[model samples]
Target: MNASDRTPADLLSSALAADPGRPLVTFYDDATGERVELSVATFANWVAKTANLLQDELSVEPGDRVALLLPAHWQTAVWLLACASVGVIADVAGDPAAADVAVSGPEPESLQAARACSGARIALALRPLGGRFPQVPEGFTDYAVEVPGQGDRFVPYAPVDPEEPGLIVAGREFSGAEVVERARAEAPELGLTGPGARILSALPYDTWEGLNAGLYGPLATDGSVVLCRNLDRLPGETVDQRIETERVTATAR
Candidate 1:
């Protein structure tokens, strides 16, 4: 981890600088039998494009609130970093009516919640290949469709203040600096001892601990994650095989 990282965005930048080709997030969807891997450079590019979408197309400004109604998937990770880059507050599973923008997964509950958002509404298909939805949902723009059209680079219109609230998880707020601090503190506890540490996490993103295990802990420590969705559906032997195959050093407990 870089001691100079004052914000989550800085952590990402450090990772990109340290090893652009190293695996960053390896995602699995047991329910769909899908596995997708992204290197640091690829992940950062996705974050850049998504941040551009939030800033240029959606006109998201610093301190604005973005309700993220997504699961612990790769795209969710991208959105979290994008929010950091754009200096907006990412509210995990937050109330849509109170948010300036809302992003939802294709799940019924999340889609239903997103309908409450009167401002910008974006939806992710969550397909294995990141394909656009067969039919775009009403009142919402397809993230897969729009994000790819955005520039691969992003520069915030205003400088992001590390002191500003950057995330809201389970109704608790945390600044960008606080996020880095908390992640650093929790990294070793989750067995991410140093750089190149690989963690396998099946936790959801709705809680602080889940967020730490799935995203922040690894990012803060210059590590990587093997993120699993519907992990409970996988057989014990299959899960064990995956752990060995991913060369994971830790598992989120």
Candidate 2:
């Protein structure tokens, strides 16, 4: 699809319809030595709910930035898709202050900023950040529990304009239009599509390569994207398990 026409939501919907049963994301937690799998259909539902919560509870409007400090968990995927569905700008940061809403994980720099910036209204965490990372302080709304039952379905706030920025990648910025353009330009050489094709990537969602190539690009072409949580904790076996278990067809770096 052309850059002007394609959107992150369009790509996600395509995957949900084409392979509702297929594993869309597999997150391996080394500390717990467990795997969490999310199928396209289930993920879509969660994303919808998340979108509604952000809109209704937090009043996150289109183009508003939500910063993510979480790991490569299934929740992170859901958050990204949800933000895209509602036309909110998902600004993933290593530091939290740069974001409007903060999703805490291993990093806390951005979370601190989110608090200092005064724009941060909501904070989401898969687990408490007592010691795992810096605390988001008190008074900030905890999105983990508050968001689950807020919305039954996702309502599109606005049709995504590719020219508008969909996500903040790396330390730089890129618009949705840029991502679709890059995907189309590189798809032929990268071999980024086709049946049974899966992409395994260690890149963080905060990076351009990860957001475009790792997540959205693969989804656009009916391929699965495997996001690894701990890139440093590896014996190659973990990667092998994901490949063997998920039947990953390809990898990008």
**Clashes per candidate (backbone, < 3 Å):** 0, 8
Tens digit of lDDT per residue, candidate 1, span 161-241? 999999999989999999999999888899999988999999999999999999999999889999999999978998899
Best by lDDT: 1
Instruction: Mark the regions of model 2 whose C-alpha exceeds 4 Å error after superposition.
Output: 1-5, 94-99, 106-110, 127-137, 188-191
Segments in model 1 whose C-alpha atoms lie over 4 Å from true places: none
TM-score on alpha carbons, each prediction:
0.98, 0.82
Residue 230, model 1: Cα distance from true site in angstroms: 0.5
Q: Rate the local accuracy (lDDT) of all candidates.
A: 0.94, 0.67
Q: What are the root-mean-square deviations of the candidates from the true structure over C-alphas? A: 0.8, 3.7
How many backbone clashes can be found in candidate 1? Answer: 0
- TM-score, candidate 2, is 0.82
**TM-score of predicted model 1?**
0.98
The candidate that wins on TM-score is 1
